[model samples]
Target: MNPQQPIKVLLIDNHPLVLDGLKALLETYSHVEVVGTAGLARAGLEVALRTQPDVVLMDINMPQVNGIDAIELFQQQLPGIRVLMLSMHDSREYISTSVLRGARGYILKDVSTEEIVAAIEAVARGETYFSSGVSDVLMERKPDENATPLTIREQEVLRLLAAGQSNRDIGQALGISAATVETHRKNLKKKLGIATTAGLTRYVIEHGLN
Candidate 1:
């Protein structure tokens, strides 16, 4: 058989076992090549800079810096590289945060190897991918009443802000950073034209979003 063209990939996760398993699984795909692995976000960033992988599979709950943070950083540094989050948690906050932070795809760790490979390939082609369960959760929420409806991530950030969480707390809870939370807050305020905390609270209550 003629050799298939390989898609370069970088795997990032704090756990060695998870990284090893993912590397092995991805290698099974004829079109995928595991170029490198990193145990933390910073190391992953360096690897990405050097290897310029077609796709990066990132784990969300890593030490020091998480996948969401890495996505923003990597996108700014290497605009051409695609980041596909590989996470164990399917929480609304986690999935929404990754999407908002510029992740091209989100796949659960428990997904089959075939699905994971498909997700990586799809993302490398500049498409979005979500595991079946993650897609269901994302689709469960109906759009808000506002004519210019907020995205899933913006809505979640607004809800958390309305509940009196600080930016740092929101970041910690959502696996993002304080700067990202602040940026989302600014965008929400601009879009909704509601700047004050009281105003946001009132808006949420008026719209029955709470």
Candidate 2:
């Protein structure tokens, strides 16, 4: 990921129009290169392996293998390659599942072309990016009444963790050590009665912690 090199991108969507339109839109940018396109998740995986794209812009709805499930496949095969979900589905379940499955960012397909490019570039840089629509959905969820309240810093850590950030990345953003981030994570889990990272993410999304 040289600063000078254009960010390579792979587009995966079931609709041919969406794939073509996005590829055309992204190609106008000097910083982005549309390396390849696929209409299916398995095919996208093959293309991704061959092209070795810096970022993957994937749709949630596809034939046979959906994008949410495909996320883990990409992560398993291409460890450091960033996956940014671009889909029309904005449901919290879809978004949260994508995060749990290792998506770096989630954006609606209706977003502006520029915003899509921004999301791709941001994720390619190893930073999480969520569309305003996705953020709004997360914000509308109400916390459970009986849930224990968290400190401001703990809430910050929970929000970042739910947004698919690594402990090191969260620590860098909050000006804390990775150990401190882990401590906050443990505290959040203890307070929320959530054991796994995926459970914590689902709780944060359901409670509007974002």
Candidate 3:
């Protein structure tokens, strides 16, 4: 697909209302065209195979297969198909897992039409886009209690975490006890409002802090 041309988009979601709303909203954009829409993963695959759209706006949960699982398939069978996940969830596990599995973007269903359109265009251009719920936690400055930026040691721990380092390994590398490393880990979680290691990793990488 030419970068300058209107991007062909395919919508795959279980909710009829969502599909209808998306179709109607996208119809207003001259640079984007909704080529097809599907309510199930199987149907989505069929639509994709038929339409060969440049981008896919897919929901996480569908009838036959979830969007994350289907991402690899589209990458394999429908090469060059940029997928921007349309989900109501902004959980770190959900969003990060989708990106780790090759999804180009993830946006919540509550997103503004402009945000949705921006996400589609960005994803179609081979860039990554995360909704406010996800990006705000990482990119936006936090309040007073959370205002303090991570310390050098905390940043080191985060980089190691992004590198897949275990607590013991991080301790060894930092010349600190594993218990202290564990403490730093917990602090990291509290400060970042992140629970899973994957979430921390994603935050670190996305902010280029790793």
Best candidate (score: TM-score): 2
Error of 3 at 126 (Å): 1.1
Clashing pairs for predicted structure model 1, backbone only:
none
Q: Which stretches of candidate 2 lie over 4 Å from their true place?
A: 140-187, 190-199, 202-210
Off by over 4 Å in 3: 137-210
Q: Model 1 segments beyond 4 Å from truth?
A: 1-4, 140-210
lDDT of 2 by residue, 1-210 (tens): 888999999999989988898899899999999999999999999999999999999999898999999998898899877999998888878987798777888999889998999898888887778899997765533435698788899989988887678899999999999999999988877777676666677566455674
Candidate 3 per-residue lDDT over residues 31-146, each given as its tens digit: 99999999988788889999889889999987679998898888878876788998877776777677666677788888899999999888876677878787764443332364
Query: In what order do the candidates fall by TM-score, top score first?
Result: 2, 3, 1
Using lDDT as the measure, the top candidate is: 2
Q: What lDDT would candidate 3 get against the real structure?
A: 0.82
Full-model lDDT for every candidate: 0.80, 0.86, 0.82
Residue-level error in angstroms, candidate 2, position 116? 0.3
RMSD of each: 9.5, 7.0, 6.6
Clash count of each predicted structure: 0, 0, 0
> Candidate 1 vs candidate 3: which has greater lDDT?
3
